[model samples]
Target: MLKREDSAVSKPEIQKVGKYDVKEELGHGAMAVVYRGYDPFINREVAIKITDTDRGNDKDSAAHRRRLFFNEARIAAMLDHPNIIHVHDAGIEGSYCYLVMEYVKGAKTLKEFNKKNEILPVEKVIEIIFKCCKALDYAHSMGVVHRDIKPSNIMMTSDMDVKIGDFSIAQIISAEVTQIGGIIGSPKYMSPEQVKEEEITSQTDLFSLGSVMYELLAHVVPFDSENVSSLVFKIVNETPLPVSHYNKDIPEELEQIVQKAMAKDPRNRYPRGLDFAADLSKVYRNLKRPVVDIKEQAKFEQMKKLNFFRGFFDSELTEVIRAGAWEQYGVGEHIITEGDIDDSFYVIISGDVLVKKGDKAIVALKPGDCFGEMGYLAKTQRTADIVSLTPVSLIKVSGTLIEKMTVHCQLRFNRIFLRTLIARLSKTSEELAKYRPL
Candidate 1:
């Protein structure tokens, strides 16, 4: 969870691991100690989590700890996201196994702001949690579920960027690994299903995130009792006091988000992190804090006006709206980064963008122009960067979700996408033919 220790129990009595030099103990828990280390090759500081070799002679405990330790390395390293901690490397050096992770220079645990006197402004909470939802959505799309998603597992940078850390107990759900069941999670933030050791999914993390959000807003956990058993009972069988009950200043729309997130039934909770983020984005607007005033219906209308959706029916457009996000960015903002592995097709619904490779402008895109054609068809990396040339509004659609649309809708959409790609190729050929010395 990237949790730091108040005091060191003992040092590892070592100077280095591979090319990294151990500086000091950053924190220590029951199983491992996080040390501040320096990577000589890259010339940067990193957090080294070294698992204890001698927890006990108990093989099961040691095995479980080792598995969990490596699990974080294997899973977190694969997740290349800004909001998720990046795992650089992992290896075994004699008896000690360790992970090299990004050292977030100056950040505070979400725990610090959950106190009654330390609550952040409502707008900031919406911004912070919105990023978390997007991050978790990305993780869920990749088949990783952070089983423990409490406040301590989430970090906020000095600039207010959110990072979800400590995937040590995260489970990889896939076709082969159908379900996971274990009474394994932080009790205070555990969902009803978690306490019961029911099959875990992305919803479980959403429920935990709800508890964190509740604590942040109301200055109290949704369900709490000094008595452990009573707390578990409350989480499983009771409805939490409405968030507005504790903090009347909290908006009803925001409270509903917390309520839906913490719903006792997984089915009642947000179907996906994308849905969670969409609602929060709406609440952000209701608070009158949106950068642009595009509501859902307005966004739908914008899409309808786009030549990209000319032949699609309103019902089909509604499905498209549900399957995508309407986002806004200021001028000079980088809409797409070169070399990033993303599969989101973007349509400029308003304003313009400059598509550049490095510093050279390859082309300029206007409203109704589309990009990510290849990405829409596969999990490919971007070759050019798309930067906003003006205040920009975009509809970002993930390839994964687009596949779930109706067959007729897909056919129409693909036909148009193919046309756009072919037209671009033809234009390039004509330009190249002019340079040929026949």
Candidate 2:
């Protein structure tokens, strides 16, 4: 946490709390201001969350709030998991109750990430949500329900590790503390039971997790409302557009897991967070196959959309299409090999292929991209292995066909082919430059 006081004289300059010195304000929430601070006792940096005293008057009212705040901290501190932020210390200093927590560097809220890239890849979305499921499962086993689970509460590091934060609304599932008929959580992510003010269970968290996963995959909330009343009504009554509806690329197995996790009836949903995680793991395995087919005509149309293929005449393209043979590959199948004695070129028709040096992918080829053309032109062995990342469809053109076309077709077609080959080589060179050493 970093804390910095405003230059305005009216505001209080944040003072040192015990052995920790406040640096600059990291963020502000409804009840507290989080700051970056250096802990002299530990000889390391940590985040300090300080409650604002301005919100309440009198010592008794302040004391009650402090007790409630520390109570939440005490519950959080008891749980130890890698995905959960560790709480170091919590105490009252003067009028403010402050909590010292682990300092995670280079983290961004999922909301901030979505504002920049509206949608993320399905693989990445699944990976993050799976981690959240495991963390939530661990918390649930300890009789804790994170009442609020949303994009804003999820922090993702640069390496793609996910941490669920802001446990202010977390409810202990003990019968003595469980509050009936009390709605507590963000409405957008609220489970049907939560909206109805029913008993909060582990299932409630699963529903919220589903909503977060839905937003991550689709880039839209599962339920939308013009007002709070309508929002609550929808949460209890409505079913969102299937994850596949927004992004057809999402596999059926994944879509099914999300749908089941978000079921309107708690009984119909995943019984525990582990169940949800297990389903997601299955989806991860299924994601290796093609989600949908890419027809030959669709492949051609996609190719025409590529920038590298600009200004290519239909007559020239027709010859290439005539010589090409469509081939389907299973996931992990090798379409070509490095140093293989084959003079065949290929163009991606559907799915994804990886050009690799041995086992490592040097480049990924989506629809419209061409590969092995340079080798075909030089009449030499492949420089890299082309392996299918997903179940793939490619248009393979043999060297013999190209030689025949060169002999039979006019020189204009040959000139066009040479130019197209050069254009593809230029694009590949530019892509390879990104991985080159500085």
TM-scores for the candidates? 0.70, 0.63
Candidate 2 Cα misplacement greater than 4 A, ranges:
1-12, 53-64, 116-118, 175-181, 288-438
lDDT values, one for every candidate = 0.82, 0.75
> For residues 1-438, what per-residue lDDT tens digits would candidate 2 score against the true structure?
323354422223585876789887788766677888899877988988888553445566455556557656867786888788788888776666788988878787888756545467887787788778878988998988888898888988776678888776687777376332367668999998898887789899899989988988887899998899999988888889998888878878888899999999999999878777766654553463332444557656765775435566666566666665666889998888787654567777678998899767687888867778766677676788888999887777655455445443435434546877777789989988999999
Q: Per-residue alpha-carbon lDDT of model 1 for 1-438, expressed as tens digits?
A: 122233433345557887788888776767787888999999999988888554455677777777787778778877988889888999877657789998887777898897667779887887778779889999999989998998888988787778898888889986464233467768999988888877888999899988888888888778878887898899999998898888888888898899999999999999888788777766665574243445779878888888988988999999888777677889999888888765568889999999998889988999999998777676677888999999988877766566567898888878988899899999999999999998
Query: How accurate locally is residue 355 in candidate 2, as Cα lDDT from 0 to 100?
Result: 83
Name the TM-score of candidate 1.
0.70
Stretch of 10 with least lDDT, candidate 2: 2-11
Off by over 4 Å in 1: 1-13, 56-60, 174-181, 289-312, 316-438
